[model samples]
Target: MEWVFWGLAAFCAGLVWFLLKIATTIWRKPLQVKKFSEAQGISGPPYRLFSGNSTDITRMTDEQNSKPMALSHDILPRVLPHLHQWSKSYGQDFIFWFGPNVRLVVPHPEIIKEILSTKFGNYPKPPTDPLARQLLGKGLVDLKGEKWAQHRKIINPAFHMDRLKGIIPTIVRSGANMLDGWSKLILLGASEIDVQKEFNDLTANVISRTAFGSSFTEGKHIFEMQTKQMILAVDSFRSVYIPGFRFLPTTKSRQRWNVEKEIRRSLRQIIDARERTAITEKSGRYGDDLLGFMMSESKEQRRVNVKSNGSLSTEEIIDECKTFYFAGHESTSVLLTWSLIYVTRNEKPETKPFNGNGFKWKLALRNGRLQGETRFTHRNAKRCCSVAFLPMKLGRLSIPAGTQLEIPILAIHHDPALWGNDANDFNSGRFNEGIAKAAKHPMAFMPFGAGPTICVGQNFAALETKSVLAMILQKFSFVTSPSYTHAPLLLPNLKPQYGAQLIFCME
Candidate 1:
């Protein structure tokens, strides 16, 4: 009887504590962050308790997602309606709330250069959306300070020009295989096909071979699981983020967890096999591919963690695999898919009149083959962001720590002030002088980003994209399919809502 009384009292005490904590988070902290921003001349859509701007965001996204857009190059309105609308109303560097957290939108190139340029000394990435962290792990994209530097240092040499050169043949081979499949499809009277889907498979194959020494077919299961997890992570799993809601025994949650577990298990097998082969072969080396580079004894040089041999933990190595495949594979695929969209729509593949972009090749079909040079648009017009871990001076404003920041790459890319009147139009001719000379600001055309955190796989992706595009051009000429719907939306990266459907005619 006495035990029951104490138990009830303890239960009441815990319930009170939990309620107080929620109150502080949902009400108190938001007021502090909002007040701090208002003092610095920053403002946005007024914050609503618990919901903040999430309701507005969800409403806008739902509206856009309901239908496809017309075939046009201006994608900002369709892809990121929330950022687009708010940036116009609140100026380029205003603040908004994602739930209780105040997010500062930073779109100007002058300021973008400063934020990404610094070491993780002051600005570190915001805590990743919980679902995303589960999908990608705490790899390079999420790691901070010394740990980031350590992992990056070990992985750097694998992307060196020399190391990447060794993989060019692999890219070429993979592209050829994909092109062969397209030829067979054309022969079988399937002239109208989705190039976006094809490019996704092509890039998957490219990354698998480079990262794990396996072809897409060899690691198809692994890629499939990661794909499912990425979709879930970016979709409803990240909606509004209720504190204890995800841990609920929901059907969707269980499925997501199962997929994630399978991913780690599959990756472990590959790494273990590679290590065993290295030991048995007496080569004292893992191959020269990315994984091989990470597993090498001499490569790391110093012990990053307190492991026996002073190398990266197997877990760290696995996380990086997820990052490279997710980041590199997805971005490059988006680049190729959009490049196809731009080129096919151009109607002319010959040299466009050079304004500033040196020489230009619009998509032209001659003698049943594509002529002229092939270049890929790394220009994502993408959206990603970071947070201020400590108070830092951003241009004129002294932003405080805990400031969440979003760098609107898409908005910056298409801003008329930066890219002239034809900013939104599909003009690959802009890169004629090279990316730097192509835009008003040096950081303006950053398809792969800039500064220290600029994508290490940039060179790898560019080469693969060109290689694949060139091969496809040699094989076929494509135009927009009549059934195609141009609905470019960001599933964390710019993607066609209905998939990039195009019609391939014999070149």
Candidate 2:
């Protein structure tokens, strides 16, 4: 009994000591970061224990999101209130806490260029949120170093311009299918449709067909799982990263874990089945298409490399598939949705637009680059200034090792000094003169990203977006629905909180 009592006391003391150590580590790390930021003269919002500046950020975000805004494209303030306030207060180069992590917000193009290009290796992609990782997988987006290099090499064939062109018919068919649904719905009169949903489904179907060589019906479960997991993951980013928190049996955690597990299981079965039946001979043409490309690459890499750690595993291939779905589907859909909304609202009667039949419309679209504005930037996490200053110099500022940096795209995009007075307006004509004349700096407009690590699927995304928009434009003329609210909220991805409701009429 005495031994038992002593054991209990010892256990309690050890637990207390362990917790104290963790607490100390957490408290000291951020302070150390803060001290480094201050020494570098990087000012930011005041820091709080554990939560850091996120509480204030959350408060501001909540307050901003709680209210609806008038129909306008200037959504930077509403979407990122903290960044807006900090930009005004501390100027461009400022530090801020994203939960417990200290982030130096670099809005200047020169500094941004240095971080993204000049010091490319120094500013690797920041660690994704654990919850987000669960959903997104350790695919190319999540990986870095040698593994990333290998994955990029293997995946390159899949997104080649030639291969992308092959998928154009699939894209057109998917868009037409969506328009068919809309046609039936709006048969009576002009229909108030959620263009966001329409584009999402369209993009999803397109990606499904393109990636898997199978229709949406086959990959619907995987799509659904990812979509649900993404919602939960986005919510998790609002708080600090707690070690082993994801392992806890909390409802959200459990849901995420279950979804992740199901996604893996479903993908495994699909892959296994795909492996069994092969219509194409394995002559190393990336199997047949995109899905085949990924699967073939993974297998061929394993067979040849054998011992190399660079080659992706079976699980890794599954992850890449998940990443492809979201990466391919989500961004394109958002661009299309925004394009439709803006075109409807900003339709100019003055400009002698292509007023002709479907064939003429197709000819015009095919002849020129689709002129549309995509101001919104979708970055998972801002870059962390964690890299050590090798020779002790980044521009005029001396950045210390372990310091974090965040490149606020929203702030840079809407800067009146950079984009001029009409920066907030949805002006697609800004790009008519080319990117050189678009903004003060070319890096100022980074919708797809900048530097060497710019989005690999950018061409694919652009082509897909143009195709969808062209189909929609050819079919109908759209205007923002009266019920549409211009509340651009950030659920990690910038989206219309109330949905992009648009009224479409057959042209």
Candidate 3:
């Protein structure tokens, strides 16, 4: 009887302790952190019990996204309503919570420089969530330390201007094929077209052929799976993230897993076939495509046995492929879509073929459309786990570990202080002297990203946009259709929710 009493007492204490632990983690610690940050002059929406600011963010986002926005360059409020609202309430640099986690938004340029530059050592790239890991893998964006350096070195050659220029003919060919279909439609009295869909298919076709060579069809299927996987992963992440629960056999998880498996299997087959070709070919070359550059470096890494450049394993290669397909396919397509919107809006439909110095193109990129938040689609950005890895001093404040840092690209790009009074309006002349002089600070114009880790495929994207748009301008003139609705959706990136409808006029 005495032993039983003692056991019951112990069990009760254990249960109480467990409850306390949950309470402390879910609310108490976050409260303390909030107080400390407030003491440091940083304030945000008051932290809630467990959901924190996520509910507020979701509400604001849902409400804003529920309607059709007018055609204007002032899209920051519609796309990132939470950030737009909070920044107004909490000043330029503020902290917000995402499900009990503290996220610090750094919008000042000096601080952004500190975060992205040499002090980059203090701030590491956040880890990818389960689905994002499947989407991007251990590619350049996710890699760190020597592994990242090695991968960067290997990937450098593929995206080099010379190499990118080599792919120009392929881009022109792909664009021409898509345009030919559009021409047929115009001849058959289909004057109106959804250019958004056209660019999506065009960019997809371009990436498939350029990245995979002879295996483009297989690459397209793999990218399609990744697209489905991204959707499932994002929908699941919109709710509070559970640490180990993603492994369970839930419906969404099962869907994500199925798509991920197909992506991996398809990518693996394509990679293996490429490798076999490299081995069998008498020249021992992997061809001049993106995959070939990595494969060549991989072979060299194995041969030298240096271990310093780091090893590129087979799985790593697969991840890189998925990353490339995801990033390359969508970002370029959205860029082209928005660029055309500005082009058709600002200039006459009969405007001549776009030149390198085309004001509308520059305005599209410079006025916070492409240049604002091209990298920020895919609402699962939280997976990057952008928390402070350790207690670190940022500018004037010393933030604790687990404090997430966000460089709000959209906020910075649309700041009136940086770009004068017409910040939200399309001002192509602002960029006449060049992007550096366009804004108060050069870093304000971060379309691809900033720091040592700026987007590697920027040249590819830029060249493709120029080639594809130039080809279109030469073939047909287009005006915004009356039926077109301007609803910019930001869940997976800034996209036209309805579709960018344009009425094509034969040139």
Candidate 4:
């Protein structure tokens, strides 16, 4: 009885000590909420201990889909509705607590520019959630300071206009191949198609061809693993606000780890084969694909580093490759998908001009394609050309250190003040004329983002999108299917929550 009592007391003591250590470690970590609130000039209710405002944030996010359907204008309303409401109640720059942390939302374009361009170094990507960082590895999107600078310098030449132009034929070929596949399906009596899935496959193939200089069939397994990884990665983002959750041996974490491992293994094999071929054949001239270009550039850097006593390790190269796969695949696909949706939704038939607008119609469709057609409505004539000056002008917006600024691009693009009353409506006709002639604020439309970090594959993406759309439009007329829902969600990038479904009719 005495021995039993002593053992029980010892166990309790050990447990208490463990708990105290954990509590102390957590309490000592710097709180993120106070600084964030001060910078944004707004405050919310006091945070709950341990949980902070995590419960409220989670509840708000879950209820987001319940909001009444509205025109898909901006993602801000959907992605952060709680923040949107708080902004209205407080101010444009408001601070919202998420768990134990607070994020300052800055909506003004001037402030956005300062954060993105001027003081970029101050706000690094928050340490990625452990699971996500493990899966994604540190790439340009996640890199900061000197690491980011080094990667950017080495990779910059790969995106030069000349290098991009060399891949145009590859882009066109991929689009044509996908279109051919769609035609086969249409012949087999499939009128309704999942355009989102089709676009995904198209982009996947394009990336594989342009990045690997090999058939997508060869890279099919890699694409498959990446697709799974993307879903898992997105899921991790939703749940990541919960502190220490990633370290647990949860099923989600295990799955993510496995997927990441597979992707890395496949990439390593591809890299090894390429290196061997370069060594044995063609006297080490690298292939012209994006991956090949990256390897070639990395090798040059490695040579320089060896001569100068500074070198990046093999792990760093692998991290970069992973980054390329994620960034290159996802962004281009989303942009192309959105562009297609815009074109399909907004395409209007050529119409005869109303009395005095005869010249407008003549200029609108030259050589059976939409070209430069500028018109000056009585209200917009003076402001039309003035729009061109916006991007170059630096407006007054003070930015403090360590502020993470987001370009509320969709908000800017769809704002009634910037784009007139019909801003929410899709109207590519607005761009048929030079953008400067059509936009009330030329800086507002930033599908490719802006400044030095704008997408490297913008031209390739545009050409591919045009080629695919042209081929599809020539053969089929499309209408929205019943299964289509307009619930836009943000997974870092905006996407339709449900797949885009459309009915296709053979022309």
Q: How many residue pairs clash in each candidate?
A: 7, 4, 2, 0
lDDT of candidates 1 onward, in order: 0.71, 0.71, 0.77, 0.59
Output the TM-score of candidate 3: 0.91
State which candidate has the highest lDDT. Answer: 3
Whole-model lDDT for model 4 versus the true structure?
Answer: 0.59
Residue 502: error of model 1 in Å?
1.3
Looking at model 1, residue 381 earns an lDDT score of 13
Clashing pairs in 1: 348-362, 349-362, 349-363, 349-364, 357-432, 358-432, 368-507
User: Where is model 4 poorest over a 10-residue stretch in terms of lDDT?
Assistant: 372-381
Higher-scoring candidate on TM-score, 2 or 4: 2
Candidate 3 lDDT score at position 1: 100
User: What is the clash tally of candidate 1?
Assistant: 7
Q: Candidate 2: misplaced stretches above 4 Å?
A: 1-36, 231-243, 250-255, 279-287, 299-310, 348-392
For candidate 4, write residues 287-332 as lDDT tens digits. 7877777878888887888765233455666676666666666555
Give model 2's TM-score versus the native structure. 0.84
Cα lDDT, model 4, residue 469: 57
Give the TM-score (vs. native) of candidate 4: 0.75
Off by over 4 Å in 1: 1-24, 214-218, 231-241, 248-258, 297-310, 348-392
Error of 1 at 37 (Å): 3.1
Model 2 lDDT, residue 354, Cα: 26
Error of 4 at 431 (Å): 4.6
The estimated TM-scores of all candidates read 0.83, 0.84, 0.91, 0.75
- Maximum-TM-score candidate: 3
